[model samples]
Target: MKAFGSIALAAAVTLGLGGVVLAKPLSRIISETGLSPEDFEVLSATSDSMLASGTPRAGKEREWINESTGSKGTIRVLEVRDNCASLQHFIRPAGVSQTRQIRTRRCRDANGNWILTP
Candidate 1:
């Protein structure tokens, strides 16, 4: 029956739209942490400057803050050997009471640029 087919199509359309509404954004899925893109930019810049300005050593640290979003964090060098360094990131997103810590590594390339590495 034409009416039955129409209803089925309408239901499918409604369910599809509902699924889209419930879908999480790609950025949110990528970063389970509450850090926004702006937050990551600020943190990256701080880490680069600290690691590139001079020879990095364990315990060297820097702090970054995004006043607009009220997100703040710290990047600390945990270890350094040769041209590579391991760092720890402490992030506190806005409106959050608990801080999240992440570990990462960077190595200076032949061009003397600090590059994030897995």
Candidate 2:
């Protein structure tokens, strides 16, 4: 009886562990940063706005906050190429403890819209 009980317990544990191993991967909640595709879009848009006229370059940095989510971060234009720009972005999601720093480059497409490259 003890041997049967032990076998049943072992099988239960093995099945539970197997299920865990096959579970779906964790979400990319932060979504952007670390050179992800999402990061490219977010940083490119912000850089384009910064390059627009009337957006002061006094401190070479801009702060943005999402009033709805309370998530905030900073964007800085590191360099501007003839047709492209490099940027540094720091993003912190609401309720997240760690902020992410990402660097990427954006260039003007034929239609004058900014796009990410490489």
Candidate 3:
């Protein structure tokens, strides 16, 4: 009976460790936005600039600017599974308006390469 209990405990410990290994890191999800470090820096700068300029532009226009500039601003990592991740980017105008915009995308990290998933 003692041996059986010990074996069960060992099994449980192994399973627990496996679960942790299978879990994904939050940063990995953010990394999947197909954004390089430079891209992230540019996005942060653009967001700061927009906020400072107090521009009240349309959401579409803001998205266009971000996309054109290759910026993935304000991304939130929702989930990470295997090499794929789900993310969302929120954009808010810099003025005294309560407008908020959100965009969602799925991306994958293939062998350390990040790419947007179709």
Best candidate according to lDDT: 1
Clash count of each predicted structure: 0, 0, 0
Question: For model 1, where is the 10-residue window of minimal lDDT?
Answer: 5-14
lDDT values, one for every candidate: 0.68, 0.51, 0.37
lDDT of 2: 0.51
What lDDT tens digits, residue by residue, belong to model 2 across residues 1-118?
3333223322322233243323231222123222333333343345556766532333378777665566667887777767776666677766777886655455677877555543
Candidate 1, residues 1-118: lDDT per residue as tens digits? 3333223322322233243334454364325667666666667678767976777989998999998789999888999988888878788989899987767677888988776654
> What lDDT does candidate 1 reach at residue 2?
34
Candidate 2 local Cα displacement, residue 117, angstroms: 2.0
> What would the TM-scores of all predictions be?
0.74, 0.54, 0.32
Which regions of candidate 1 fall more than 4 Å away from where they truly are? 1-26
Question: Top model by TM-score, which number?
Answer: 1
TM-score: the better of candidates 1 and 2? 1
Judge candidate 3 against the unseen true structure and give its global Cα lDDT, from 0 to 1.
Answer: 0.37
Cα distance off (Å), candidate 3, residue 90: 1.6
Clash-forming residue pairs, model 2: none
CA shift of 50, model 1, Å? 0.3
Tens-digit lDDT track of model 3 for 1-118: 3333223322322233243334344344224333433444454444333333332233323332244444433544455566544444443323213423333323334445333332
